[model samples]
Target: MMSNSTGLLLHNAKDDDDEQSPFEEVAANISNKDDPTILCLTFRSVFIGILLTCFDSVVFQFFAYRTSPLDINIGLIILLAYMMGEFMSKVLPEKIFNITINPGAFSIKEHALITIMATSGTTTTFAIKAITVQRIYYNYPVTHVNGILFILVMHLLAFSIAGILKRYLVWPASMIWPKTLMSCCLMRILNIENQTETTETRWTMSRSKFFWLVVLFQFLWYWFPGYIFPLLSMFSFICMIAPHNIVFSQITGANGLGLGVLQFD
Candidate 1:
């Protein structure tokens, strides 16, 4: 029942579309693949990475318990980091007393590394429940020293195990780090340094405009689920039928072992 001519035409169009896979972007940007400058493991990178990680961790921890959990987007982080790095590069003296301390330029490599460090710390602290259970439920003795040590040990143990196995499953260059790749693309699109061209009106949306548009949309839309009509997030015909059936609703309700069948109403 298929037409061979149409299929052949589609195949030919695909071949002519400049078949460049986005995942291979990390490999494509190298003029000399052996050059190590792209790694961006400088002193400035470490300093910025640490600062951003602290900020990112705070943002994530603050939102962890909110009814409408909000994630600080990586693109936003990259934008902020770029602005801060640029400000320092331009305003800060590159050398003090003829001793060079600052690079005076923020490389894409440095930006990427900073983003990666921040991301690692932003994940939800899974060991929080253990501390809570010990303190609140069991009424066991809990001190700041042991609590901090317990968290560090748990976090480091997972890191150590994964790191040891990373050479096999994670450290390979062939593995496309999806999150890193996305961050890279965002950086490339938002690169604002060393520009000399005048702005032009475009048919397609620019990244800056698109970013603000998304922010505006999400800000306006979330109110419906968070306040105005909270039931939009989780609704079921079963709930409407038997409003008083506590047992049935418990099993098929939002945040209550339900399948999470969402409905508009």
Candidate 2:
């Protein structure tokens, strides 16, 4: 997950700022015959692309159910949504339909927002699964506690594995995750820096707005579980306690939160 965000930030294909030396000759030749109309058109098209992504993400979240067509994986849906967006841009008429698709509309802020939404759903699903597994199995008593422990251990193992593989997968900069490529292309379209400067340090206005929005939200969101509503963070503990009662146990199983049957059984 951290690597995903890192890729969004360091997509050098989209941002020339990663290069130390500006391609001055290339820029000079291009600027000599620069077309403002083309630039505007490209920007418009890219904006459409970002909008399409946002729309697809939202639609998938709304209609995607826990089973059947709705049961599709979020990551798969995101990829499909991006493809659909790309397709629409190419096939859909711009003026006749009064809609345009452009990859330039995607910014760092938009990417982060989309990612957070996508990840939040995935996390919730995993958490629910962990709860289910605990209640169904471990009939030896203290099943709830054991289940919580199981979840923690599994997450720790996942993180550990990710850490072990990070050096090989992420450090060399050659692991071209395809989704990363799509994101980079969109980000590049969004950036407005003239191609002359290889390393422009100034933040684009859109990027600045997005950066602060994320910062503010991150600071504020953590406060709820971290301080104000601390119990929200201890949901698993609450779940364990509630399961000690018969009513809660019935409710748990009914709500699909109990792990009454383990596969091993």
Candidate 3:
């Protein structure tokens, strides 16, 4: 009886240790907890999501024609959605036509849903590219109705393929994507409340404050490389030293072979 009890205790201890082991990247970043009461598909979220989607699609498609296309990433959309949600909460009346438009404080779930919708809209579909190529290069003009159908068909096909491969590609523990992890981390950081208690650091800044500061710094810094001095974008000292040397250009030039090239921008 004593021997059996000892063996059982050892087994339980092993299980406990396994439970307390270092978490996987997905588990570490994403929360497993679900709040049933949290409103995800509220009027405000849908409104903001659709609005941003239209704005992003138009802006992105317009920029696609430019030499340097501008892309509105998911992070920007997330931040924008949060601000809009907050604004609506404060300005909008509690009940309109006996319907709850602003459901108290903006929940994280709503923020996440809006982010997903806005991000989806920002992506320029392959169908658009294919249609453009067909029309311009092949000289095959498609009717407006036919173009819409073609886009729909392409999307449906893609969704079907994704559904089929999801088990192997998405559900597996080994299929860890760095980009997905980064997005999840950003979402968590944005949603989490700032710690009021000050730390012992020289500059005690909140997460949101730090994020905005970085954005401001990057915005100011980009002007130098992007417009003021384009050469600063790809400054290769070796190429400057030997402008006429083919070997040096091949090894150090940004447009060439670029063997030992380093870009600061």
Predicted structure with the largest TM-score when compared to the true one: 3
| Candidate number achieving the greatest lDDT relative to the actual structure | 3
- Tens-place lDDT per residue, model 2, 137-201, is 74433456776686678778877998999878854433445554444434333333323333664
lDDT, model 3, position 165: 96
Model 1, runs deviating above 4 Å? 1-34, 97-99, 191-265
Give residue 12's error in model 2 in angstroms.
Answer: 18
TM-score, per-candidate, Cα-based: 0.59, 0.30, 0.77
**Model 3 scores what on Cα lDDT?**
0.80
Q: Write the per-residue lDDT of candidate 3 for residues 1-265, one digit (tens) a residue.
A: 5698899999975554344213476776665555689889999999999999899989998898689999787778888988998888899888989999988888888888888888877878888898899999999988899999999999899989999999788655556777767776776767775544555565567666777788899999999888998888887887888899998898889898766665656
Cα lDDT over the full model 1: 0.70
Which sequence of candidate numbers ranks them by TM-score, best first?
3, 1, 2
User: What local lDDT does model 3 show for residue 38?
Assistant: 85
For model 2, the superposed segments whose C-alpha errors exceed 4 Å read 1-65, 69-120, 123-144, 187-265
